[model samples]
Target chain A: MVKKLPALVGLAVLLVLPQVLGAEYSWLVLLLNRALIFAIMAIGLNLLTGFAGQISIGHAAFMAVGAFTSYGLGKFVGIPFWGALPIAGLAAGLVGYALGFPALRLSGHYLAIATLGFGVAVPQVLNLWESLTGGWTGVKPAAPYLLGISFREDRPFYYLILIALFIMAGLAVNLIKSRTGRAFIALRDSEVAAQAMGISLTKYKTQAFALSAFYAGIGGSLYAHMINYISPHDFGSGISMELFTIICLGGLASVNGSIVGAIFMSFLPKLTERISLVIQKSGAFEHSHFLQNVFKNFNQVLTGIILILVVLYLPMGLVDLWRKTKNLFTAKGVK
Target chain B: MAILELKGVTVRFGGLVAVNALDLSVEQGSIHGLIGPNGAGKSTVFNVLSRYYDPAEGTATFEGKDLLGAQPHDVINRGIARTFQNVELFKGLSVMDNLMVGQHHNFRYGLLPALLSRILPSVKREEAEKRAKALEVLEFLGIAAYKDAFPAFLPYGIQKRVEFARALVSQPKLILLDEPAAGMNEQETHDLAQLIRIMRDKYKTTVLLVEHDMSLVMSICEHITVMEFGRKIADGTPAEVQNNPAVIKAYLGEEEEAANA
Candidate 1:
């Protein structure tokens, strides 16, 4: 029971966040909701890249596929939003399974290039396929309502995403503890050893891809409903890079790291924008337009520096940092 | 009766024959050793038997079933497990988890079943049982104290023993030990020979070992096969092989010269 204290505290904070913050700024809830949804996707991607030792730069394509599939199923096909999400996940999982084929034959940079091709190709295909994807304009999904409760409000939707995040995160944790999860780690550590131990490489590699895609798909489905708007632009390579950055920041192979990464990604941009505004108003760069221009893009530069520093120093990520911190505090007899 | 038989197994690497036509048999319930010079292809024979390499020409039968029909991954399920020349324990996983991985074939549960194990009683029971069996093997191998430790933190000898415990957990009908006493001191090597004997006598498991340590091989192995340049130079009881002129000229003579020096 004591082991669950931190989780309970975290849950309490999540439950009270909107109530406490909604009175002052309502938009923060929406941002937090988006972050939670991305957390699910990050958890899934970490399983593929961190645990399974598969490199993919095209994860955003899976999200795009999920968004589009859920949009079509929920809007055109008349399936309810609740049902459409899973169907979208299924669609993305199938494609991911197909992508796993190339993974079997190629690895490292070769596999990354192959997946990058998929990422680059997806938005183009979506833009050209106007009949289904609405071309460049994209589509707006209808607001979801379940069991007489309208999720149109930000708070309700925030709760929905929180619930989804917890469930998906729990499932990922459970998976990492099971036999199949062991197979993934074994394969990652040593392929020859894994195969000699009765783990089928073809089966588990593809399954990891499919499972990760399934998570990304659910995330995309939730994203489509949350913002009520999505286009190819929303899930381009930039989003993929952002997801990768989140995993790196949160720590690889850590489910908790995925959540922390999503939170960092969600808030860091806003924090930078505020800093940029302060710098612009300070008039410190008034003497030179070049310095002013540099100040304007300072946030990007800072984020890049932070990423570099983290890679150099905290290679294991924020999760490792958190563990060390907890260890230090607990050693002080906090319990 | 022979538990494993390799007939006319030929493996070629481009222009070079890594393992020439080799015929060998490991009788059930015995400790057998394969000893050879550095390039004698002792490891290649293991690769062929484990289905890691498809022989250019040969047939391997385990328990009278065609081994070539099985894939590399399927070999473990067919009652065979092997340790690598270079230790291949998962670096990040604990010792206990490594041993548990050996019992992977014991649990027939798939992904869906594993996920639903929380709700399914039988699957949950299977998981607990596998864990119990893994712990039992750890105890049997006397590595229970290191169960929670990672492989990188353990001593080299302990790491090797953990690998043995891992193979033993699966309860394979035949276990292959590749260079088991490669990096051990005299005392550790003697202990390993004793453990190998114990595994055969107490556990009733067949061991097919490849060792460069002649003392351990002569002391423990009931039968020994000597190979030179990928072909069988001598195969017989340890006494006969020790006396064979071909074996002496190919392998033992160099050892004897080094000893004298």
Candidate 2:
């Protein structure tokens, strides 16, 4: 019960926040929604990278597949937002499943390079195909609607992202506890042992890719609908790197860690911007715009510093830190 | 009757020839031992049986079925499970979870059922039952206290026993235990020998173990196969192999060669 109290409180806050806060905290609401969407993507990547021990730097490419699929299905095929979501996931999943073949042949840094090539290729493909994707300018998908509620604004749409997060989070939790989930961890620990235990490496690896893509696809669909625009510029290697970093920054092999990581990533820029505003007004670097630019890019620098610190001091990430703290307290009390 | 048979099995890594034209049989409900000196290809035989290394030539049959064609993953489904020379327990997972992985073949529920386990009572029941079965295996191995603890935290002897429980949880017809007593103390090795006998007596499961521990091998195993430089030097009962001049020369020759060099 103690373990579940925070999530229950969080759910209540999510349900009540938009109604109580009004327009003053509209940005907060939007940020939360975006964070939830990214959280969904991070959860998927955690399974592949943390549990399955496969490095994929092209995660955002799967999201791109999803976003464009939603656009194509919604705009060209006239599919409703509800209908387009699963279809978009399917499209991305199929592509991810195909990528698993190359993943099996390559590993470690070679796998990272292969996935980087894929990450770079997706946006190029989006830009090159002038007819389907609208080339450089990209496609502008309309705001999604369903059941008499227009999700043109951030408040109502927050519920959709929330619901998706809940379902996907539940699915991830369920998966990690099941036989297949055990197989994934086994694969990460020792492939030879896992194979000896009757886990098909090829089958599980592809399944991990497909499932990760499905989550990414759902997140992309939500993103496309929320942003009301689709452009190749919206996705790049940077976004994929962010997704990978979020999981690592939060915790590996942890569901709650992904959520925490997504929230941190989503709010980081705003936090930095606020700091920059304070720094600019304080007259610390009053003479030059170059110094102001430094403040503007402070988030990137801080992110790099944090990544280094996390790698050096907290290799298992924040989740392990939490466990250590809890263990310390419990041990003292018991003693 | 033999549960496993290897007829003229040969495995070569480049030109090294790890195992050469080996013929071996493991009888059902018997503790069989494969013993040899270093680089004698004892572990290589286990690898070939587990299908980790495909043999250059030969046929391996398990319970009258052609085992050579079976995929590595399918070895457990065909009622064969193996432990590694260096314990391959999932260090991240708890000891119980590692055993649960052994019961992979028993999980009949597909993706939907697993995902919706809370909503569906039957799936919940199956999951509970699986957990119970895993706990039972842990209790059987006398490692129930460490079930919730990660394998890395456990002592080396306990970790090896957990690996044994893991393979046993699958209820395999034949288990290939590779160097189970490698890092164990004398007491632990004696305990493992007794456990192997109990496993054979109570469960009637066949065991094919590869080890360099002569006392444990001679005490527990009804039959033994000795290898030297990728070839069978001797195959007989413990006393017979002890008396065999070829087996003595096989061990003495290696030490003498090392001394002379």
Candidate 3:
């Protein structure tokens, strides 16, 4: 119970955040909702690449499938957003399962390349199927409704996203602690040893892909509903790269790392904007258009530098850094 | 009765024949040893039994069931477990979790059940039982204290013991131990010999081990097979194998004609 206090408090803070922000800071609420969606995707991707040790560079394709499937179901079939969410997730899961067949034979950089190909190809496919997807023009999904309430406003929708994130993250934690999760880690450590212990690679690999994709799909559905509009470009290779970056920067194989990483990623651009504003106000580089351009793209440069530093020094990720610091303080106290 | 049989088993890696027309049998409830110089195909034979390598021409069976037809992962389910030539404990997992993975076959729950384990009573019960079983094995091996520690941080001897504990947790009928005493000190080797016997007596497990440590092998193995260049040169009791001229020649190299003079 003592160990769970921080998590409980964090959840409490999340619950009351929108109310605290009030109506004037509604934009921040929208940003937080986006962070929640990314958190959901990060959790799923972490399960695959972190615990299962299967690399997927095409995760956004799963998200795209979920987004488009939900949109199509809602607009043409007249299905409600809530009903389309699960179906969209399943559609993405099927695609992930199909992708797992190639994954079974590939590993390391080879798998990364295969997934990269997938990430690049999905948006093209979306663009080609113009009649169904509206091509490059994209589609605006209707606001979600349930019972008597319309989740059209950012505030109410934030709660919906939070609830979804809670359920998915909880399930991810459950899976990670179970036998299936052990099998994944087993195979990751040594295929020969894992197989000798009766862990079927074909079974677990495909299962990981399918499950990871399912989570990505749910996240995508939430993203589409929250943003109100999405095009193929929204789920492009860049988004896939960003999702990959989130896991690496946050920590691999850690659920908390995924959430923390997603939140950090969501707030990074805003943080950079604040930094640029401070610089401009100082009048140090007001006349330098070159410096202004550099600050404009500062988030990407910072993300790249942090990713390299993390990989070189903190391979276990930001979560491991937290653990190390706590251990350090405790050790000093004992001394 | 022969618990495992390899009839005319042969494994070839391109031009080199690893195990050539090797016929060997291990009896039920016996401590069997396979020993030879490096590259004599002792590990190859173990690999064949584990289904890591397919024999170009051979029929391998476990308790009269076709072993060769089974997949690598299926071998454990068919009551055969093995340790690697090098300790292959899952480094990222805790010692207890490594042993839990060894009991993968015992957990019958699927993905959905595992996901809902918190709410499902049956899943929770199964998890508890498996954890208890893992703890029991760890205690039996005297490594229960390190259950929560990762294998990478443990000493070499302890890591090997953890590997043994992992294989034993599955409760396999036949446990193939490849070079179990490879890097052990004299005292650890002695303890390992005792442990092998204990495993057989306590669990009714048949043991097949490959080792370069002659004293430990001669003391523990009830039956021995000596191979040279993938051919079985000698097979008998430890004393008989020690006396065989061919086995002596294989180990000592041809008695030099000049030395004989």
| Top TM-score model | 3
Instruction: Give the clashing pairs for model 1.
Output: none
Question: After TM-score superposition, what is the CA distance of residue B246 in candidate 3 from its true location, in Å?
Answer: 1.4
Order of models, best DockQ first: 3, 2, 1
Best model number under DockQ: 3
- Tell me how far the alpha carbon of residue B151 in candidate 1 is from the true structure, in angstroms, after superposition: 1.4
What is the C-alpha local distance difference test score of each model?
Answer: 0.88, 0.87, 0.90
Per-residue lDDT tens digits of candidate 2, residues A1-335? 76786568767876887789777788898888889899999999999998889989989999998998998898888998889999999898999999998799888899999998998999898888777678888888788877788999998898888889989999999888887788889999999999999999999998888889888988888899898888886889998999999999888888888987898878876776677678767888767879877876776777667668877887787666766776898889952
lDDT of 3 by residue, B1-261 (tens): 999998999999999999989989999999999999999999999988888899999899899999999999999999999999899999879998998899999988899988877888998898889889989988989999999999989999999999999999999999999999989999999999999999899989999999999999999999999999999999999999998888877888776433655
TM-score of each: 0.96, 0.95, 0.97
Judging by DockQ, tell me the better candidate of 2 and 3: 3
Query: iRMS for all predictions?
Result: 1.3, 1.1, 0.8
Docking class of 3: high
Docking model 1 quality class = medium
lDDT of 1 by residue, B22-93 (tens): 999999998899999998999999888788899999899999999998998999999999998989998867
Candidate 3 has which clashing residue pairs, if any?
A: none
Q: Candidate 1 at A291: error in angstroms?
A: 3.3
Supply every candidate's count of residue pairs whose N, Cα or C atoms clash at under 3 angstroms.
Answer: 0, 0, 0
